[model samples]
Target: MTCPLLKEDLIFNLTQGLGYEERSLALYEEFLTMLEGKELSAEEIHDKEIIERIASDERRHITIAKRLIVIAEEYYHTT
Candidate 1:
């Protein structure tokens, strides 16, 4: 699934590298909390399903954030 944060520049900055692991995990936890509290938009609902699937795979925020960090690192490297 495509990350909702992929288009968010600030989130990109926050999860840019392995050095920010703690912060990244915190951010994702906050994001999940926010998501859980509201009636999701159509897109968000779709994303939520995807997130649930991934989460059920035993992938926690730290693992997801680490992957995002790797992607962000590659992005920074290219541009």
Candidate 2:
């Protein structure tokens, strides 16, 4: 079952989540850009791999957040 949240609460959480996801995506992109044109050190390679994995997770979080927001909207409209 879905936890009940006030309209403002739902919006607040969704806005915060999107902000986090946006920042996370930018940070990951920046990391990738920094390493893109240059040769990667062994350490850099490891960092990049880890970052890539985290970036994927961040993207998933973004999608989930978006879906939740939509659900919240529907819930509010229906009720």
Per residue, candidate 2 scores C-alpha lDDT tens digits across 1-79 of 5557788888888989899998989999898878897888899899899999999999999998889889888888887
Best by lDDT: 2
Per-residue error for 21 in candidate 1, Å, reads 1.2
State the displacement of the C-alpha of residue 52, model 1, in Å, after optimal TM-score superposition.
6.3
Report the lDDT tens digits of candidate 1 across residue range 1-79: 4444444574556556434555544555566777887987899998877755654443455577677667766765575
Report lDDT per candidate: 0.61, 0.88
Off by over 4 Å in 1: 1-19, 49-79
Which pairs of residues collide in model 2? Answer: none
lDDT of 1 at 71: 71
Q: Over 4 Å off in model 2, which ranges?
A: 1-4
Model 1 RMSD vs true structure: 11.6
Clashes of each: 0, 0
